[model samples]
Target: MKTYFPYQLKYVGVLFVFIAIVLSCIGNVDEFMRGLLAGRNDFETSILNEEATKVDQTLAYQPYFSEKEKDNYLKISLILSLSGFILYLFSKEKSEDEFYQQLRAKCLTQALLVTWLFTGLIYWIRPTYQLNGFYILQLHLIFFTIIYVYNKKWKFGTE
Candidate 1:
């Protein structure tokens, strides 16, 4: 069995996550720059001061890849975060042994089962609420980490 992510990519994954975090916090790139120059949050100030016009308010409703691209940034950040997380999770460990591979497979299977169950329960409880790709990915990552930690700590701790 081969590892899809090289051990060195662990550092890259961390960098990607950091970048994603920064991206997620950023509201509008143009506005952030303006805020930096003005030494304040330009968007909020504009709206609060009644300086934001109808056109400025309509910026968020623009096309995804349009000039502003407010929501696009958030979507990109989410995708980068998920990709980085998976890369980090599956990256080769120091040992890279058969036991580790088997454990990874087992943990992933258990994670998938648990994520599906959780998703079903959430929908059963709230039928009108919709789950997005990022939400599902987060659940998958959460369950995978939990299962992986449990297996490593309890099932094979003595080994």
Candidate 2:
């Protein structure tokens, strides 16, 4: 079996990550900007409100985003993030060597172990409440982070 994935897969993974971040940030940045400027300077209030109203009218009806819309965004973000992480994890390293292959295997094992432990704890501790899809998405994020960290650490050693 091939030990290393194509280097290009890493770039594709990064692109997915970027797209996911942008998708997730759009609503948040809109809200933040509105909040930050909403009460500032009485003169700008009218302009801001007018602009906000116009923008709201032009955009889809989900101002605060309905539950369905939020769920859709969350699902898309999760898929993109998971894809990116998997690609990043498997992509070839700069130097594809036996040690690197061993490190990759170890990182995958460690991440899987940690992910399952956290998943079990979440399931056992908060059964119903933790059943939200976001929690599973978060678990995947944690798993990815674990793999990334261990890979980085082992690749560079303790320097």
Candidate 3:
């Protein structure tokens, strides 16, 4: 019988948008990673004078990222996807509690950290096309900061 605050809905809406944006960027990164694998093969085959498979040049390969780096990229993807889903399910007015607040903070922190790592990796790799897209990083930072500030006075502060 408890009614939820209107601001609660807004908070949920903002979180959902943040989650959606992060998810979309992660999906694009995954596609790019696949292209990188294909491009590496193509580069090797071309060097050997073998036929190279058609590679989408638009999908560029990140130079200097070894297998470990590639696996790290995938790890973030899985973490973000799973955490985002869990947050969405628990982000409700009636369900709002310390648990939910802590969950949101944790999810945002993970997303921001992953964003920073990914951007740093791309910068370190120095791709051929100078793929310096930091939009996703900025978005995550803004969202994380906003949410952290909002939850600071709440029971779950940076949990």
* Lowest lDDT block of 10, candidate 3: 1-10
lDDT of 2 by residue, 21-139 (tens): 77777635546655655444344545677576554444433257655776678679777877887677778777777776777676667776887788889778988754556556556
Which residue runs does candidate 3 get wrong by more than 4 Å? 1-94, 127-134, 137-159
Backbone clashes for every candidate come to 0, 0, 0
Q: On residues 16-82, what C-alpha lDDT tens digit does candidate 3 reach at each position?
A: 5566556556546756777767777667667754334433344356554555665565556545544
Per-candidate TM vs. native? 0.64, 0.61, 0.31
Q: Highest lDDT, which number?
A: 1
Error in Å for residue 97 of model 2: 1.4
Best by TM-score: 1
Clashing pairs in 1: none
lDDT of 1 by residue, 48-153 (tens): 6665554345444322244457677888888888888777778988768998888988888989999999999999999999999777987798688778768877
Output the TM-score of candidate 2: 0.61
User: What's the distance in Å from true for residue 129, model 1?
Assistant: 0.9
lDDT of 2 at 96: 74
What's the C-alpha lDDT at position 66 in model 3? 59
